[model samples]
Target: MKPLNDVIAACPPSGIRRFFDIAAEMDDVISLGVGEPDFVTPWRIREAGIFALEHGYTTYTSNAGLPELRRLICEDLEKRYGARYAWDTECLITTGVSEGLDLALRVLLNPGDEVIVPEPCYVAYEPCVSFAGGTPVRVATRWEADFAIDPDAVEAAITPRTKAILIGSPANPTGAVQPRAALEGLVRLAERHDLYLISDEIYDRLTYDDTHVCLGAVPGARERTVVLGGFSKAQAMTGWRVGWICAPQAVAELCVRVHQYTMLCAPHVSQIAAVEALKEAEGDVREMVADYDRRRRVFVKGLREIGLECPEPGGAFYAFPSIRASGLDSETFAERLLHEESVAVVPGDVFGPSGEGHIRCSYATALPQLEEALVRIDRFLGSLR
Candidate 1:
């Protein structure tokens, strides 16, 4: 063939999808690999989408998003997170948090700019930074500290080329929530260094034990932070491809321009659904979070009983347990579990180098499947012994 962009060529296959594809080929496999809510989109939200379609609301919206949807997003942020964002100047609805991440990087990064990322995070950040022509500087979070961001380590990673710090609270893979103190410390560092803060709060509503603290809510941090959120996890609307970014007026204006060229506006019907989801699906979100909490406890307790060491996750739906004690690396452990026990999970190393000894098990599935998966895991562990 001719040639492809080196960045595209350098990207590896998605780690989360690899196991999911393998599981698809096997019969009766219980999958905990994908980090998606298993619940259906609430009927009210679905009805809104259907209503829009019935009313012939299929046309493209403004590049920034539907005005009403943008207004609802602003209102929701103010009501829920105590944050204020101008609908006209401070927000741009996107295809999903995935696009929001990309837009943030595209708008802010220049070639060779450095973006600080914490290790054992979601699989997207580093590659996204690379694609945006930024260098990703990873700082490791220790399991012994419950994976809290170490301020000193983050400070040490910053250089003159540093442009932004990427933070995902109620983080993926590890399910660690950054505490308010940690967030404040990071905000201070961003302020001191004059760098942007990309706060990925897609899992903000899935927290089990503590309230989610928005970085924008911190003093002086709002101006420098770009908050990314979506309806995928909390409202069971992953397939809808609805998300948004909230930034200060100046940055948001640039984001909207980039959004205009990349993918103009989120889908109109999906925006209608997302607005309804925020307005009426509060109960659904709570029920799903509560259910995930139950599954988290069940899975974590079972893993501990089987002699696997897993940290207590404060938020998000995943349980990242170390499988090293079982005498296998994470990749081998996950492969053996899928092939031998009919259970599927993501290997920890897929997240980053720091995750080598662990495996991420999502609790987004039903209770029965979770129970059965635990039983299979127990049997597999016993056989190892």
Candidate 2:
């Protein structure tokens, strides 16, 4: 057999999906494995898509995407974060944050370049760097420290070849929202080293009590940061596959260049729907955020009651709870729980080596489902004891 591309072949499958696949084949299962908003795309957003489809608005948008969507995205960014982006040259609508992230990496990385990635980040980060022909230099963020990326660790990881820093807050798996000071420290680090910043803000609107500090809005970060955002988590528009990149004019242009040569443009209907999402979905977003806050309280409290000591999640809909008390590594704990209690969770070690003693459980499900899953999780822990 012919050998496949080395970089592509070397990438491991997503660990978050292992338990999810298992649960899918089972008749009675509670899955907290997938990192998605359980909420359907808001009614109005879906209706916009439907209207577009009916009206034959299926043509390809500009390579940079629909100007209207880009404008709305910029407007929303300015209103929400005081981050001003010149709609035409500084914004791009991507297929989703996934594509946006890939574009950002491609535009920035050269073969053998190093991108410092904070540990326990989203699964695709390292692989994306590899695919972009860059080296991924991982810096661990401790659960003990609320999974915050320590600037000291990040600084120590930097090297002559280091070109960028990739970060996600209200982060996946851990749900750690980096505080403003912490983020500023990171920005300083980037400025000191002349490094680019790739800030994945896909879960931006999914945050609970904490305010999401837009990295691009930071004083020293705007020119160097690539802000990846989307409608998936907040607008519950995952299936619509609409996301965006906000960056400096030069970087934005290069990203669009790669995007045009590769993805061409984001789906026209999806862009239209995203426009509607930006215009009319604030109430829907506020409602969803409030609900997620309620779930976060109940779920984190429930996790603590069951003997799993979890650091309070500052944002996002996940609770990354320590499983060390069970004397089980993350994989073993998550596997046994699935078979023993029919509750599925992602083994945290897959997120990074620093995640070895924990498991990531999403609380994006309905409150009743979350409560029931907690009960099963409690029983599973009891059996482990």
Candidate 3:
């Protein structure tokens, strides 16, 4: 029989999801593989969704989203990140940051366009680039540099075909926040090359030390950067499927056109919830971030005590540690840890080639779960020696 689209066929199952699937069937498994907040949606936010449903407000919103929600998004962006965008012309609420990423790639890339991605990144960027018929040029960011993007390396990778640079600050898996200097350099490069800058700041609010820096806040960057953010991480609304993209007016208009055909709009009820989330949920986000920060300290210190080389993550809830000293490849180490210790983690190579010999452990679980998982990991490492 004739088969699937070759592009679809070429895409492998997500490395992160596959491990979670296995762990789901195992008894007494402790999974640190999923990159989701452990917190519940704020009661007020959940009630807003429920209230919307009870009021029969389930109909589809305008393709761009509810205007009030868009306005709130604009206000939130400016108030939090020092970035200003026109609510009506510069925002499109998406199904999630995942869809925002998709729309950005679709709207900006043409066949043969090249997108520069930093390795050990969120797993989706390369596949999304490939699906968009663009080449993904991955530049490896070393743990030695705390996974910071090196402007020299990025500039070296660019060619005439290069169309954009995709950045994830408070990056997934690594939890590495790009320093202000690095962001400034990247913005300068984008200007020099006249390339688009897609900054995924989904984990913006999860920072432990420094305040979140929006690339759009840099000089001349507001016009060139497409900022992607959502309710998933900050507000514990992962299942709500609500996110938004803020871009230049022209690019946002184009993205909305594509979004109209692809997802119509983010779910109406979720949009309502998200508006409430932005306004009334700050305390919930603050509390969750504080909890995760404590977990981050405990987890990193525990790993270091076990001889694992873990850099202190600045944001997000993950710890990317080198397991090469255990004399096992990342996949082998992960498999044995799950089977023997019943502690599940994603192999670092799932992010990119540069991530081999490492593993990603999310500290988004409760303290008890994280502490137990660490004990199991220590035992597994000791057994290796």
Candidate 4:
């Protein structure tokens, strides 16, 4: 037998999914582990895909995607964040943010290049960098600071090998949205060091308290930034598998060069559906955001009442709560709660070392499920005591 690729062979499987799989095998398991929105795709967007099929529009689009969709993406970003990019030369339609992340990494990284990734991040960040042949330098973000990236730590981690800074906002697991000032500082760092900024803004529309600062909108960042966005989280279009990458023309050209030889194009039907999402689904997105806000309020308060302290998650649906009170490490806490109380959550350490004492619970579930999950969690904590 031949050997597998060493980098991938050594990479760990997604910790978020391990417990999710376990829960899938059990009945009555209250799973709050996955970050997916519970809402289905808005009717209009789904109908657009159906309409495309009926109208025989299933042919592959140009490697860049449908021009109309790309234009909408550019217009939406400019309207929302003052960022400008050419719809034709600077935007690419990817299968999803996952594929966009891979494409962006492949486009920017060479072997041994480094990407500074802030911790308590989404599970995929580090692995994706590794898969792209880059070293992922993890900078820890503390629970004390609500998991915000410290520019000083990031600056200290920078070396000649460092080529980019990868970040996810309205971040998964922790739900900590990076502050605007910090984003500015990061842009300054990138500008000074001639590094790239890979900003994953998938949850851009799901913020509850703070506005999402677009990294590309930062005065000097856009020229060096790769913005990865999709309709999955807010538009509830996960199954549609459509997303985009917005970057400078040179970077985008290379991305399309690689994409054309690889993915070729995003699914035509999905691209059509995504166009409808960008154009006509704003009201649907607003209603979903409002509903998530309500669920966020209930879930966070419930967690507090149960004595598990959690930082205020400004944007994403997850709540990374400290389970240090349980006298168990995050892995034990999450594992025991799942078996004993039928509540599923992810151990925070899977995100990074700094997440050791916490567990990630998604509030994206229905109100009643969240309430029940909280009750079960409280009882589980009592049992531990």
Error of 4 at 375 (Å): 0.7
lDDT string for model 3 (115-218, tens) is 99998999999999999989999999999999999999999999999999999999998999999989999999999999999999999999988667999988
Candidate 1 lDDT over residue span 196-292, tens digit each: 9999999999898757887788877899999999999989999999999999998899999998987988999999999898778899888888888
Tens-digit lDDT string for candidate 4 (1-385): 9999999999988898889899999999998988888999999999999999999998989999999999999999999889999999999999999999999999999999999999978888999999999999999999898888889999999999999999998788788999998899999999899999999999988898658998999999989999999989999999889999999999999999989999999999999999999889999999999999999989999999999998989988989899998899999999999999999999999999999999999988999999999899999988877
Every candidate's lDDT = 0.92, 0.91, 0.93, 0.92
Q: Can you give the TM-score per candidate against the true fold?
A: 0.98, 0.98, 0.98, 0.99
Q: Once model 3 is optimally superposed onto the true structure by TM-score, how far is the C-alpha of residue 202 displaced, in angstroms? A: 0.5
Spell out the clash pairs found in candidate 3: none
Candidate 4 worst ten-residue window by lDDT: 204-213
Candidate 2, 338-365: lDDT as tens digits: 8889988999889889889999998989
Error of 3 at 349 (Å): 0.7
| Ten-residue region with minimum lDDT total, candidate 2 | 203-212
Cα lDDT for residue 322, candidate 3? 95
Model 3: CA > 4 A from native: none
**RMSD to the hidden true structure, all candidates:** 1.0, 1.0, 0.9, 0.8
